[model samples]
Target: MILHKDFASVVGVRRIGKTSLVRVSFNDLKDNIIPLSINLGRLNGKNYSVEDFSRLFLEGVTDLIKNYTFVVKLPE
Candidate 1:
């Protein structure tokens, strides 16, 4: 579904392994796709704002870019 540009949502009660399932899937597809995993539950009790979410999202992207390698080919 992801390869076809379709999005997937895993809905279930807490502690039912939803996160684990997504993590495993992401690991399996790591070579083919870049995965950004963020846990919003950490902000469940704090006074968080949009900036917090944006920071987390950007941090994830930055980490991925720093850890992964991409190559571009040029025509000669």
Candidate 2:
């Protein structure tokens, strides 16, 4: 999925290793891809607006850049 640039969702009951499977897959492909994992569960049970979602999304992106800053080359 990473190689082909396809999106995937791992859906299952709680504690069923969905997160683990994705983590391991991304770890193995770390050198070949940038992985961004955002948990929207934080918004659950609350009145989340677009701004809230944007904040979380940007936070995820910021974290991804921090983690791969040395690994990926940026254009000038």
Which candidate's TM-score is highest? 2
Model 2 deviation from the true structure expressed as Cα RMSD, one decimal place: 5.2
Worst 10 residues of 2 by lDDT: 1-10
Q: Which ten residues in a row have the lowest lDDT in candidate 1?
A: 36-45
Tens digits of per-residue lDDT for model 2 on 1-76? 4356677877777777887899999888746777788877767547889988898899999999888777657899
Candidate 2 lDDT at 20 equals: 89
Expressed as tens digits, the lDDT of each residue in 1-76 for candidate 1 is 5565656778677799989999888888846776666766666557889888888878878888877877689899
lDDT of 2 at 73: 75
TM-score of each: 0.56, 0.68
lDDT of each: 0.77, 0.80
lDDT of 2 at 55: 88
